[model samples]
Target: MLGNSLASSPLATLGLAKCFHHSAGEFATYTNVLPLGLNSSHHGLTGGVGTSRNKWIVVCSTTQVETSSEDPKTWEECKEALSCFDFSVEEKDKILGKAFGHIHSPYWTEERAKESPKVETLNQILEFLRSLGLSDEDLHKVVKKFPEVLGCSLEEEMKPNIGILENQWGITGKSLRNLLLRNPKVLGFNVDCKGDCAAQCTRCWVRF
Candidate 1:
């Protein structure tokens, strides 16, 4: 074991920090990401197990959505499979007991945008969450409230990976993260890489 923070971190353990930092870049600067397990995956070596976040706090959307996955990679397929639905925010309790935002949206068909009254929103909530380095417990709570605004929505066509979500995941986490990075408007989630931006992103992530 290379190291372990009181909280989890992408590079918590020196065991994989050297390699993980080289690839994922900005997604590993945090002090809360844990190396739940080891993997001798694709590179003929260890890869992220992707099971650490096996449980999710499913964020409920105010509109009709077929939420099959929230993994980065699978999100594309989900959007493609999606048919347009009128946007609306759902009601839910607070997370970390901190006041979170969820504005009502008459964000309806392209036709209604001009007429409907706009409201406050959580467009950048995910970014704030990542910056704070919230614990899994808090994260699960946050995700559970905003199904409409997932940090990373899954692709409708991605294959299921039970080892990842432990729930009814017909998709994987990598796919979900992909979706998160791609759809910044929904969550504004950033991938924190280590070494390069570690010093800077860390300061920003914390200060924010």
Candidate 2:
């Protein structure tokens, strides 16, 4: 039965959004992100000298954040982090909005929201995905699908799961990349339990 669910959707057995939740302590370590001291004036296209014209700009809207508290300030950091990607302003807004909503829902209290992952962590997640050979379009789709991924611990969660997919299931290169796009939720699974999870998925695929 578990294998059947994995064959249908790799994350269905784990419960969709529940897989992403972790103890507040897991997020506490990331709360000290150095603020960029950003303000309404900082909103605009950002490109360093000699940088390629194709690079996307960090476009911050004055209206994106409504307060000066730590929670809202985290949104500013998120906007800065997303600037490193190739997404357009509109795309960035959508991604940022989704992330903002996810972290602010009833599931996340004011304290947890304030302790959310910072700019540096968010960039690390994006860079890791890019290293996996995801194009800009694919990256956008994954982030939009699983905004909670921004809060995941790279060393603890993402890498281990990818390792299981490669070493255990032999899913690599293009096949691995396509699988991730189809089921970005797989990244949220706790690494310690992922081996058994992937094993079940393997059995289901073999049965088919």
Candidate 3:
């Protein structure tokens, strides 16, 4: 069902260009500028310029270059990084496509996209989820629905939220799995707010 839904998802139609429009003009301008000692005859001189978290970066190469803070990972690279997982090619594509669609969301930024998540960190997340009894299919569905989960801190956001659900509200086993599949975004909710009424209400609802 998740696979079928992804096939018809609007994110499937969106391109990297659309999500990274903020840097389009800058990229075009830098690409056209010839580096010293290179002329129009130098056919392979490719360059890109953009800002990440306010730091300006210029990348140019005759061949492909490594990703840096200034040049974060593309959607393709993000998918490739997840190759260690058991996801099908189509599933990987759909997952990253949905993720790229959220470039401007508070959880992600244009600059962050170029760098992407580290392989080691992603592995930790997968392992943690597996420890909670999530199967490969469940993992795929959760990531597909809320790809930003990839960006959440393992110890800070994910662990604490899951802990609250299990320890405070007794939502474990099948109920926990069902809740995650139904709304993975709940893991990102700020359930630790001390005095906020909204957070208190959320806690109340969970207890009920």
Candidate 4:
């Protein structure tokens, strides 16, 4: 599902609106997100950057307490921890989002280098994209043009495609190809906001 959050950089969101040619911020629903503090706090999720890196990002105020308490627990535990009165609903939403975003099946979390690519399935997906009128040249152009800044390979980032492994990289898959075809812009990726937004962006919050 697409979100209307201005959390994305202006250029990307604007370009997306222009591409789809519709205004949709109010129509889009906010995903689950929660704020959390550093590992020293009681409510923060545990794990190292190397573990969760870029898989999910958290936005929180500096005054908030960060904790690793939720890190060691399962999703059920994390869900409960989010209700503690020490934090507000808005704050809890942010932290929960990060953990949820990063919580993949143990299979996906393994070192990507060691995993085998789903070559056969990827080929069929690639064929599907081609049938949709996306040319080989276009696919190459789009994937290469985007650089998939957010994923190790576009396929690794999402289970739906193999195109991410391509782009001239040794990877391969087709599920990603379809996903990219759907949201080609995201293939370009973005850097983390580091939980701070110094650049003002028209009070992007709903402030509900």
Candidate 5:
């Protein structure tokens, strides 16, 4: 039920990775994502600032004939799309494992992995979390309990919320990291809204 609760929460909704299944066009296992007249270096999923929006877009190369399938029509297609990333088998297993097994439901199958956070993105998030001084086990626990945190933006979401916890609620250093390990979902609250992160954190802290 933790997985289901996370999947439906606003924090998860804000940070959860989106898959290409929502697209109106046909689905292809290896759809070319290049922008019109742009080379691969200048196309989709680029890391450089101003190169592209921080969202994923599925596009077919101009040279390829469009397929007729409206979407990922089968489990195989969904698996292919999700596994097309550059990550290795071990990494894929980790992500998908946490997604499917952690939740103890068929809710997030391969279809969900296709749209879940990229391995690289998840690794970046993990790296930032590590800097917070959490042990490997605690770090894994945080992610396993709240896998949706993988989709959060380092600057916009994670750091800002952590900042609110520290600045407003005085949850600094080890105490903060420990708090997160206890309940990573606390990071999902929008500290920028209403009374902001502090007020929200206050409410949660008292209950925590």
Candidate 6:
């Protein structure tokens, strides 16, 4: 009689609705006897008025999103992947975190990590930038800000563009360094469109 009264009450259904949306971790608590098919998985409820009186049910969904699978690889895998590049543990940590400015990007996946571009090519680019007078610390900062620079063409792209900024625009040495720190994206700008590229760089420079 008590179970039938509770199950048929509209107030009990309202209370159940309130419980469902309470919070992520909390769950509704109730006790009742009902027909076997009275509960609904979609409606998130169980129990009903039935003549059987011998069965009870509890229904809820336990689905949860998995975030760990999104991570490309472990720290050890990152170190091993970059093994041929002469990076220390600390340096590897920085490189992994700042490679694409956000380690969570799809580029950090295991497949992409395995297919990383040639270490020798990246070394040449790093060396050229170092030759341009950026210290190791400054180079890391630049790479952190714009990791795509590692994949840029040195002869046809980076050199000509950097030369124009320093020579044509008179942004050399300290000024150039300041400009890079202010907007590292300029390093990846297309030098083929020198006018547009220089205009964008100038605008960004003026803003800072």
The best candidate by lDDT is: 3
Once superposed on the true structure, which residue ranges of model 1 sit more than 4 Å away at CA? 1-73, 76-128, 151-208
Q: How should the candidates be ordered by TM-score, best one leading?
A: 3, 2, 5, 6, 4, 1
Report, for every candidate in turn, its global Cα lDDT versus the true structure.
Answer: 0.28, 0.52, 0.54, 0.33, 0.46, 0.48
Model 1 C-alpha RMSD to native: 22.9
TM-score of each: 0.18, 0.50, 0.50, 0.21, 0.42, 0.42
Model 2 residue 174 lDDT score: 99
Model 5, global lDDT: 0.46
Candidate 6: C-alpha lDDT = 0.48
Q: Name the regions of candidate 4 deviating beyond 4 angstroms.
A: 1-113, 146-208
**Which model is ahead, 3 or 5, in terms of lDDT?**
3
Where in model 3 is the C-alpha error above 4 Å? 1-78, 84-102, 106-115, 191-208
lDDT of 1 by residue, 99-198 (tens): 2122222211122111111111232343344443444444444455433343122332111221222244443345544433433223322323443554
What is the per-residue lDDT of model 6 for residues 98-157, given as tens digits with 9 covering 90 to 100? 442323333223322322334556667777877777777777677666655664567866
Q: How far is candidate 2 from the true structure (C-alpha RMSD, Å)?
A: 19.4
Which scores better on lDDT, 4 or 6? 6
Backbone clashes in each candidate structure, one number apiece? 43, 0, 4, 24, 2, 0
Candidate 2 versus the native: TM-score? 0.50
- The global Cα lDDT (0 to 1) of model 2 is 0.52
Better-scoring candidate (lDDT), 1 or 5: 5
Indicate the residue-level lDDT of 14 in model 1. 32
The predicted structure with the larger TM-score, 3 or 5, is 3
Which pairs of residues collide in candidate 2?
none
List clashing residue pairs in candidate 3. 72-114, 72-115, 73-114, 73-115
